[model samples]
Target: MRQKEIQLNSDELRSYIDSVGYEKDNLLEQLRKETQDLGDESIMQVGSSQGKLLEIICRIGNFNKCIELGVFTGYSSICIAKGINDEGRLFAIDISEKYTSIAKKYWEKSGLDHKITLILDEAINVLDTFIDDGLKGTFDFIFIDADKSNYIEYYKKSFDLIRSGGIIAIDNTIWKGKVFDNDDQTQSTKTIRDLNMLISNDPMVSQCIITMYDGMTLCLKK
Candidate 1:
């Protein structure tokens, strides 16, 4: 018989996974605590396991050029920067100086300030600028976790910016499991659902949705 997929249905299971899935970084732990102090907004920060996964993906792919559309408190940025070589660079784009201010502090604490360049602008503007600058197909990896309504647009520009064989990792694809609720019809849910449908049928890329955290879709340009 085929084995059934395991579900992290209980706090015990989740705690177990958190314990052994990846080694904990003290700096990240501290970052998590500090972010939590921000109250509800801390929810925007990626979970530790997800951050670790991002680091591993960057390291395994040996990706040098990276782009992150959302740099909340810099946990994920630091993780990505750590995975890259000394000379690798990550262009972290965010519109909020308030939140990114926190990220800057951690980036410095992690000694990854040189590897990350923070861009304070609308994500679309930066993406378009890259395309207009004739930088198409130059990025090795792109991570999108910004505004839900602009996800489709971000994916389009990210596809253009990413080279063949590059990976574009999109977070919140599951949108807290709302994508499957046909009646929701909210703009954000509809957009994510539509993007999932688009990628599932598209032949230009191979994709899989990892049901971790809010759910992340990793698409490899082919």
Candidate 2:
């Protein structure tokens, strides 16, 4: 028997998935519209399908202690917060007060403000602080969608902070298909490519790259 493979190669197919992939939440739709008003930076926000995927992952894992490395306008943060148990907490770190201010409003509108704690600081600094605070191997889930150049550093620190069996979800691993272009030796592209190679060969975790909105690499700590 021939195996069936589906490719999302057209606008119609993508739109179809957006329509039926998950239940639409009015709050998220409102947040998307608000983020879109930011012009080009709006692209930084996670797609609805990817947000739904994050929520599902947290729900399935019963994740309580979660960390979001980059909380741009808080779309993914909301999804993760909604997925975790009621008593769960999400540590959302971002350096942009202008952007995360929008996230804060939406978190309040979504009634998730109580569940998320926003930290305004460099991601590496915050990760180091978590380590210094004796948070090693204690987090349940970590979603990394920050600066591409520092992805490896973020992954290294996140790995130490996450408990065994926890997961680390890295977004934009495909780098908008730039990873396939050997000519593109840019810092961000090179970093993502290197990180992909590192994770694939590392015995510390089992990993899978899902071709969702952009691409998400899920690493389960061993």
Candidate 3:
């Protein structure tokens, strides 16, 4: 294949298709637009375009089980739930009942309310409970976009919950490029940078730090 052709992204390909008056072009574009409107403005919220790509990946994986460490306003949850849900189950943990109720509306609207199981509590506590209940290596996918300070803790728990050949994605792992910036040595950046190095050298999974919206470390469990 030619270099230019190989360089085209999913978005560029979609745009090219729309230019040719493809039948599904309008609907696809609309989906992109609408998702952004409902999504929150938090640093934690993955953008609509990226979220759409992730949702499609989850759908195609047909993963039966997923665990999400954070459910900030439910944008990412909605994206993941839309993908894998005939017999699938999503275990999402977050402490905010108020934010979750807002996400509940979208889940019901998408008719994916049953696909997700929202747990309102601390992540460490919930994960420990899952471990105690013999849920080791049960999940096919796990996403960690929560408290940055406890990233390593989440990584360890996710490693145990995810089955072999499963994928684990950690958001803000690059900390908006701040991990490399030595402007501050505060605990947050230090923790993230420390984990970045730690995971790079971890033997349990092969990691790729993709330079997406933020730096996303996508790990495939070995």
- The TM-score values for the models, in the order shown, are 0.96, 0.96, 0.81
Model 1 residue 85 CA deviation in Å = 1.5
Q: Give the TM-score of candidate 3.
A: 0.81
- Reference-based lDDT, residue 76, model 2: 98
Each model's C-alpha lDDT? 0.93, 0.95, 0.78
How far in Å is the alpha carbon of 177 misplaced in model 3?
1.3
Candidate 1, residues 105-222, lDDT tens digits: the string is 9999999999999999999999999999999999999999999999999999999999999999999998987999998999999999999998899899999999888899999999
Q: What is every candidate's alpha-carbon RMSD to the true fold?
A: 1.6, 1.6, 5.0
How high a TM-score does candidate 1 get? 0.96
Off by over 4 Å in 2: 1-9
Candidate 2 per-residue lDDT, tens place, 1-222, comes to 998777654687788988797889999999999999999999999989899999999999999999999999999999999999999999999999999999999999999899999999999999999999999999999999999999999999999999999999999998888898999999999999999999999899999999887899999999
lDDT of 1 at 82: 90
Return the clash pairs for model 2, or none.
Answer: none
Worst 10 residues of 3 by lDDT: 21-30
Scanning candidate 2 in windows of ten residues, the lowest lDDT window is 4-13
In the predicted model 3, the residue pairs found to clash are: none
The CA root-mean-square deviation of candidate 2, after full C-alpha superposition on the true structure, stands at: 1.6
lDDT of 3 by residue, 12-97 (tens): 75466446522232333443455456556444566555566557768777777998888866777877887786888889889888
How big is the positional error of residue 15 in model 1, measured in Å on the Cα after superposition?
Answer: 1.7
